[model samples]
Target chain A: MELDPKRYAGKRLLRREIPLSTTALREALQHQYFKQIPTLRKEKNILYCNRCNATQPHLQNINCQNCGSTHLYCRNCIQMGRVSYCEFFYEWAGPNPDWHIHNNPCAWEGELTKHQQIAADAIDQTMKQNGKLLVHAVCGAGKTEMLFQGIATSLQQGKRICLATPRADVVRELLPRFQQAFPTVTVQALYGGSPDKTGDGQLILATTHQLLRFYHAFDVLIIDEIDAFPFHADPMLHVASEKAKKQTCASIFLTATPRQKEKRQIAAKTLPHVFVPVRFHGQPLPVPASKLCFGLHKQLRKGTLPKGLLRWLHNRRNPTRQVLVFLPTVVLADRLQEEAIEVLLPFTQKILPKRETETLIRTVHAADKDREAKVQAFRNRETAIILTTTILERGVTFPSVDVAILDAAHDVFDEAALVQIAGRAGRSPADPTGEVVFFHEGRSDAMDKAVRAIQVMNRRAKRL
Target chain B: MNLCVGCGEAYTSRPSWSTFFWPERISLLCKDCEGSFHRLKDSGCPSCMKQIGSSICSDCLKWEKTSYQGVLEKNVSLYSYEPFMQDYIARWKYRGDYVLGKVFEVEFQKLYYQHFQDTKYEVVPIPLSAERMAERGFNQAGELAAFTRAKRKDVLGRKHGEKQSKRSRLHRLTAENPFQLLSEPPQYAVLIDDIYTTGTTLRHAAQVLQENGTDFVAAFTLIRG
Candidate 1:
């Protein structure tokens, strides 16, 4: 059976993923449009995976089960189909996908703020020039809206566009918004278990992990959350993003907090950038206040909320406002939830003498089975307080909620996480001054940097 | 930091008295991933180890009525083929994540010692057909057999046919035996496989060994569905 060239075009897929016999694959490769590359490239003693661009350390030698040979397979991308020495990654070396140029593709009716408009225009210019640009906007600066004009213009020019983020939740959240914004365009979202396997969409929204399946598939590759986990930390993800885009494609990085390397590049004027300090509502970012709790971990270990935390919860400026408590780890969050339900709930109930029914305090973590339901319950005001780990630090919003980070000095709560956690509050214009407090045993350098970063952004917003 | 082969998360093994001397014995799976696999209970059929209380299971009784009667003396499996094992097998075998097979090495070795240590049985992993071997790159049973210190003998050869996983139970039971003895059979033989679904594959291989004058044939599988 002959394989369809169109279906396989621009896709770097494993041999098993492609449904073609060896002879059929060989016949297809006879054409100038088809090509098959070795899955693992040997260099001296090291092996590199061509699919995920994983190198020596991420590749391990294994006894090949099917071939009975000792071969190196990529451990980095083992979650995807394992690519061993005997395996080959097939690709269609045909022409680039010809996208349909539609007129006025964007259906977004909302207007971008003046700050957003500037970044949008700069993004348009950068996309036109096939250049790199960093969109360092505040968390609530409407970063998605700022990309509409540039993306729409690119779509009108019949170019394929990709918006890759590090987190799957962000990909899910952006899918509907982008679909509504450009109803005429084909927008496909790709993640680990996503049903859409075809890489034929004109505009693809995917987690960075999904980018390994594409080879020169996009004309404009916009990476959202550039400094997020697994993206900034893994060199393989960076290589995947680079390999996913065309040689001359425009690469736009969107991040609220740029990493030190990117910051250095921007400062050195090697990379062009646009910074939007003020949010769409023109409000300053909420600066986190630090309160030193002498023995935070000791109190938490003893299964009791610290006095400073209990006092803060009791004396909240708006007692009706919901509270989000961020713990350093899941175990701590679970432990505190039990203590909060028993001790903190009744204490708050005493403060609110009129309310008779008890309020709900829930704990949520990445592995929580009912994480979506619990988060939805909090959104519906069914749950008054939520204790979570850094999983909820970004990509989620709740209106009029005070943020508190217990054990802020813990290495888990880095500068980016602290800023994003603080950003979670003050998102709604109706309550733009939500309180953010860092209840720590001793202030770490990350805590100090985060507080100073917020103040700097606020100061910049005032100058604007 | 050690990365779990089951779920690619960085984990640090807790320092215990065992680690104080043999610190190089790092675990390949995290606590949660290791806990997901369900071990089979001892209270099962004595023949095939299916959870049907003490006596021989119906499948074993039916196997006794066939021409290959009394071929398989006993079969012992380590896991119960739970939902987690399904996914684990899919990733390790079908997806070809070879390192994932290492996640079971220690446990499989312990199970092997418990069942087959006292006997002098020749370890023979169920061989894959040449086509399937070339396609999958390695036999899963072959990798599992390596966990034990026993020398594995490749004495049985399989014919190319449809995968047993894709076949219905009725078809599997009625299918022709695919095993051919490659050399003289050992007096005492133990067949190693990744799974024992209907036990037809093992029975067919055991029948070939028994026909070749092997005194006893026992099967050791990772999962018993």
Candidate 2:
């Protein structure tokens, strides 16, 4: 007897949520209507999360220090339910869904560029064939728009699609865009504390952590920011992501910075990928120039920026322009904020207008309150310059903003981070060539690699 | 590999004279974790066995002044709720790690036999609410009672509400009767819980059994918080 998979389709019910007991299931088994339907597949020793499909051993053991139970709970996917040694989680393995049909779902009227159209067609073809592909596009290359065709194709075929990213912020940002593109398809953002936890949605925009609660739920899984933090580093989340998709589901990896391993796989012809080197506006990436500046940390500690850096800041001051000063660490950013106010304010007051002096500098890091408001202020040109840590390195766009890396030679400033930070400038069509300066004690290989990567992309874009 | 229940680390045992004397006894915890748990000595309150300088602890004195005074005669706890024991107990109770109950099997069995071997009392593990039992999978007290020789019964049950550990001390004292008598209890009953936190839960449980015609009740907890 095969269970109807349509009965469990888009239904993510925890055992606690099921208002029935083993006796009720037994009764169902004895009943005339449900007697022929296959019941749950029982698994022991390893409790599987029916909501996220995360199995035992992959689940982290969380000891409750308050109650003194050694193996009292599961923390791996605890938000769904505490899957313990005593409990069992079940899955429905009966039949596949029959309704793979829908109307024209995409409502977006925007046209893709020639380069974007070619890549978009390839994506749709690959998705239809259930193939794995890496969409290796540069930052600001209309990567999100290229995904629209593939998403629309999947929706028209009535297949479940999930667009997962590494961070919650990206999920939130992509939710409305996806909803606007596929207005007919049900789109819901799935993250921690999401309101639509139990609702069935055809399209799911979720953080990678949220995928732990989904077991073989999607027919198509698109992982945006494939090389981002937590998703790139954590293997448990990778397992969860894989577990969330159907066995024959197509996977699409979207990233600006491809890892060495991914690149090698692509080179070896084992992984299929499409590269879009040019920006949507048909412009090359802004290249960063490095300048040698020794003892900047000592100067920051001594309450003064170097004369050359101060002069550069003074020269770049305009009401229409915003500057981003990237620091290596939060502590360094905080210390520099105090020193900048003391040393740079008097210098700014002597040169700039009074209203502009009020919005000279603001500092933001991971711990800062009103983070969104501060970032909005910078975007609106209310702040002339904002000093920050690596939190604002990626997924942030500000028009006509110049970037300065405080210590580009620092070990924390890897090539990927440098490339992302450099990408912050020259994003908008109106300001397609903004200044990116790397003030370093000594030029590191990471800095050189970043410059070389940008030059290679520009060369490729020009040839295309 | 046999792992330590306290720290979840694999530890090997060396042959020693203690092992020879007690051949049946096995090393349940790693050496470092074994050293961290501090067992209570006989130099404290006779009522709850807390390490006060008097026979009656201040907590027991405070309990006596309450409305449900003298219901719980005495409570003999095994270990002090030190940081290590706190973590050990938490893992067993809240985390649903039922296998960690093996660490306390031998010593708790010894205590159960030594204290109530001659007494005609039934061991009643504090019953979990339907919601909590489904969530935690097993009751910590019920699992711990497997070590004792007394006949266990589902004599008392609790109405689901806010957990006692989540409530303040004042609120816990003023909390309403959450326990219900499921079946006829024996003349003497022995209450079992994982920890003796503020003693309000134990006092309430003891009061319910006493109100239902049980002559006397004592408590045995794994740790005294």
Q: Write the per-residue lDDT of candidate 1 for residues A9-61, one digit (tens) a residue.
A: 66788877877777777777776457778887767866678888778557887
The digit string of per-residue lDDT tens for model 1 on B1-225 reads: 777877778887787886687664567789989899999988999888999878888888888898868888999999988878898899878777777787787888889988888657779999999988776677899888888767678899999999999999999989999999999888888899999999999999999989889999999999999
Each candidate's fnat, listed in order, reads 0.71, 0.00
lDDT tens readout by residue for model 2, A1-464: 33345545534444564445767655544542121211122386545444344454434443333345544234445545565533344444334566446678888899999989988998999899999999988888888899888888887788998888887666766788888887777788987667766535778888888777666788899998888887897776887788788889999999898989899999999999999999888888889988777787676656456665776776764424567888888878776777776666654443334655656778888768767678777877676678888878887777788888888888888888899899888888887877788998878999999999999999999987
Query: For this target, which candidate reaches the highest DockQ against the unseen true structure?
Result: 1
Q: Which DockQ-derived CAPRI band holds candidate 1?
A: acceptable
Q: DockQ numbers for every candidate?
A: 0.47, 0.07
Where is model 1 chain B poorest over a 10-residue stretch in terms of lDDT? B18-27
TM-score of 1: 0.81
Per-model TM-score (chain A alone): 0.93, 0.83
Q: In model 1, what lDDT does residue B29 have?
A: 82
TM-score of each: 0.81, 0.68
